[model samples]
Target: MTRQAISSYKQELLDTARTLRQQIRAGEFTSTTSGLASGLMQGNIVILTADWAQDFLHFCQLNPVSCPLIAMSRPGEPLLPELGKDIDIRSDVPEYNLFVDGELTQTRTDIADLWNDQMVTFVLGCSFSFEEALQRAGLAIRNIDLGRNVSMYDSSLATTPSSRFHGNTVVTMRPFSPADAIRAIQVTTRLPKAHGAPVHIGRPDLIGIDDLATPQYGDSVPVHDDEIPVFWACGVTPQVAIRNAKPPICITHVPGKMLVTDKLNDELAIL
Candidate 1:
């Protein structure tokens, strides 16, 4: 594995997120937010018109594991004061994916031009929040060590529908030795908002994943021979849900490139 040296920072979670957001807003940080601004909450962004908000909200409620809704913005409001002091949804995220009629149309660094009074933004909890927890527990995350985006795949497991939204669950995978996998589950279980625990372990075939080497999203890292592949419910499940919903216009964070929020990771822990 090619390990990258991550710089050590003394700033607190809110300070870190604040500084990171500046870079993101300036179009300087366009890559995945994984392992960045550690201990702060990271969210998957999903924006849709008010007309489609209710069904999508219901879809999130139906699939809590994959779509743990955090803070949502009022229609036409771009600032999410509840999640951060002044989080501007239009430019807080490093990257955004615009989908039209179930097809991805373009990727944007900022969505200020697309913002409208009819649009509502949804912030879903992300697994990246627990990576810090795992590291605190002394487990090394392969994706962070390798400086690659976490591997994600479209699973065969179907999500419950809400009017127009319905699709398969998407899962993020991390390879670990059996012992570490067990510890990872325990470490992550405390962070319910961060996708909680492993949804599947050991057998990829059971989840209809034909090849671990070819993930549907993000870069694939090597899973060693002695390690088992561990899957966790991912925030990106909404993207699949959005594709099936087929709204005239939908916006989402490019998978892995998330919005760093000021909320602390420990604040999301149930225990």
Candidate 2:
């Protein structure tokens, strides 16, 4: 595409992202953010009090693949201007999982009521940010085609510990023919912020996933006989860490849902 054409396309994507965020903030769109705002970056959110923020930040540093830190907000600061104009962390995500002492108490559309002076928001890079690239490379995304959330599993693979945070890594799975899988890997390797490449390919059993039909999170997607399941480190890994750490209060985006940002996905790509 020519520069002018590409610029127009990207502006459209930015407009879509901003509209989606507004809908989310207004409690109008609360579904999984799998296929919307194509060509833009999406993020996984984790909000914690100042007391637990340092440890969680360290945890992200230790496990860069699962928790690629993109943007972080200061305590009690709802705005993340670095991500986009008027990006309100508290109300931008479609759905928020409220955790109390390591247990999910409820799902909320907005967290403005819970936001306090000590709360800090952490935005992690999400694999969803790379889906548009895969499609651009002529690969079909099964989960998006199926119009369901991507299947996610809790792998026995462990993340390196940091202070009080420790837990198994969570991964997102997508099925592709061997040839397409290779191309998919090549396409995603450029976006380290989007978990880079598949952590595991082929057999699910090797990764401690007993059955793909029943994912620990998100919707189940079938793996065709000719295709293999490709797993990438997921941003949800922090939820497992939160469970282990048992912070007094924590908030995160729902499993399949995420926060859409105005940044173009290719802007973060490594050429």
* TM-score top scorer: 2
**Which candidate ranks first by lDDT, i.e. highest?**
2
> Please, what are the lDDT tens digits per residue for candidate 2 over residues 1-271?
9999988988888888888888999999999999899888899999999999999999999999999999989899999998899798888999999999999999989888898999999999999999989999999999999999999999999999998999999999999999999999999999999999999998888989999999999999888899999999999999999999999999999998999998989888998
Candidate 2 TM-score, C-alpha based: 0.98
Question: Candidates' TM-scores?
Answer: 0.95, 0.98
Predictions in order: lDDT: 0.92, 0.93
Give me the displacement of residue 111 in model 2, in angstroms. Answer: 0.9
Q: Put down candidate 1 lDDT per residue, 131-164, tens digits, no spaces.
A: 9999999999999999999999999988898999
Query: Which RMSD does model 2 reach against the true structure?
Result: 0.9
lDDT score at residue 162, model 1, on the 0-100 scale = 91
